[model samples]
Target: MLRHRRAACYRCLFEEPAEAPSCADAGVLGPVVGAIGGAAAGLALALVHGDRTVSGALLVFDDLRRGADPRIVRFAPRGGCPACAKAPILPSLSPSISPLAAPLRVTETS
Candidate 1:
């Protein structure tokens, strides 16, 4: 769950006064509208799929969070990620088939 402090900070940093209204100012109607929209979307999904479980709800929540904020997608780094210098390179593509498809090299000296 997201904390109110972080949300407030994000609002202050990224949102404009005229364009972005504070959550506190939004009052009861804001939460109501959000709940209604979310429930409607979930109902639509359930109608289409005929199944809605805890995992499904979580997946929906994850999708919504990602859709709402792109920064959430990069929240955590993979354990064995070479680009971040945290792990060794693990190539998936063959060198002969696509020489140009190699990952961009970054020297530590620079």
Candidate 2:
């Protein structure tokens, strides 16, 4: 597996502070608001992209910092997920794991 710690470091170096996003809330209401906000955003994007499938509506926000601070935002790689160089996954008969997902191309985009 190839790691790009250097690229990530550079992304952080170029980042600037942006104003607080509109999602701020306090206490128990915070999670509820975030969830609803995510769902709404997904729905709105789905309409724009012309994809209504459940998978299409789902947005995977991988916060490497895991919500440590909202002011900091890392860059998403242009190539997206690194899928192509992965070794073949053995089919999982276990119900816990879903059957093999469609293969993803990991080739680096120029």
**Number of backbone collisions per candidate, in order?**
0, 1
Worst 10 residues of 1 by lDDT: 1-10
TM-scores for all candidates: the values are 0.21, 0.22
Query: How many clashes in candidate 2?
Result: 1
Q: All candidates' lDDT scores?
A: 0.35, 0.37
lDDT per residue as tens, model 2, 1-110: 01132233221222322333232221335676687587667666765676533321223444575865233234433232222113322225333323322333355668
Error (Å) of candidate 2 at residue 41 is 0.4
Residue 65, model 1: Cα distance from true site in angstroms = 28
Instruction: For candidate 2, list the clashing residue pairs, or say none.
Output: 84-106
lDDT (10s digit) by residue, model 1, range 1-110 = 12121122211222222333344444435665686578657766765575423211212233455446222211233333332233423334433222212244455763
